[model samples]
Target: MPSVQIKICGLTTREALDAAIAARADYCGFVFYPPSPRTLTPVAARDLADRAGARIGKVGLFVDPDDALLAQGVEAGSLDAIQLHGRETPARAAEVRARFGLPVWKAIPVTAAADIERAAEYREAADLILFDARTPKGALPGGMGLKFDWSLLAGYDSPIPWGLAGGLTPHNVCEAIRATRAPLVDTSSGVESAPGEKDIGKIAAFCAAVRSA
Candidate 1:
């Protein structure tokens, strides 16, 4: 199998961003949602985006964003893709993709086998389908360090490109890849020492684990 692609998300500081780059992460994610501690201002995202300079993919994560918010994030972050983590429908995702002229990644919250079928709904609407653990109602959508059964995805046919997230860390990412053969893997809280504080050593360790997986 090919090396698992890694995405280190929820980056808010230059030191963290630099650590992700040095770790050879395939993508660096910036949160645009205000509720998350990792959220970044457009101005802040611009500085980090400039520093990134195409060395790695820059993804902007939003939750039910308006067009103005999307525009701000795209331009500010020089984003290569937009990740919609809200309760957006397929039509809405398509609209966001058309308006931004960038690839759209729709996050699917999974709890059971039936939830995996939901990816079919975004077949034409999204470039990728992110299967993250389902958080409880009234809680944050993701990045909560929760995990579902990996066997749920084993050998399941998917209509679009998919990845694994939720509760993944350096210790378990290798097993995740082996179990799901996830083309990509994402981490936010898992690599952080706190809710939003990304640890440099953890970042490197996670990436190394993925590469070796």
Candidate 2:
């Protein structure tokens, strides 16, 4: 299998951003959802993103956000890509792309084989696809740190690049890569000391595992 591409999501601090950069993560995700503990203001996101520079891809994560908010995020000039982590339709994804002229990644929640079928819809709408664990009923959409069965992705294929996320940590990342052979993998709570608190050591360890996979 090829080496995994690591994306550290929900970053809120310069320390964490620096840690992610030093770890050489392929992508750094900034949450724009207000309910999420890792959420960042547009200004804050821009600052961290500016600090990240060109060392990694900056991803703006949102959950069914309005076009105005999305426009503000894009105008901030910190993000290279947008990740729709909500119940957005394929048309909405396309609209965001067309309006902003930025790459789009639509996140799909997977818990069963049927869930995998949803990937087909976003394949044409997004430049990339993110497979994350399904948020339980009555819960927030994402950043819950939950993981679904990796075996479910064994035969998954799509024209767009795909990423595996949720509950990924230093210990299980290698196995997750080996099982799903995901070219890209993302983590948020898994590398944190607590909810919204990123641990630099864990970040480094997780990156090391990804590089060695």
lDDT of 2 by residue, 102-195 (tens): 9999999998988878888887789998999998887877778899999999977767799999889999999999899899999998999989
TM-score of each: 0.99, 0.96
- The number of the candidate with the highest TM-score is 1
Lowest lDDT 10-residue stretch of candidate 1: 1-10
Q: For all candidates, what are the clash counts?
A: 0, 0
Q: Candidate 1: deviation at residue 80, Å?
A: 0.3
lDDT of each: 0.95, 0.89
Where is model 1 more than 4 Å wrong at Cα?
Answer: none
lDDT of 1 by residue, 1-213 (tens): 877788999999999999999999999999999999999998899999999998899999999999999999999999999999999999999999999899999999999999999999999999999999999999999999999999999997888888999999999999999999999999999999999999999999999999989
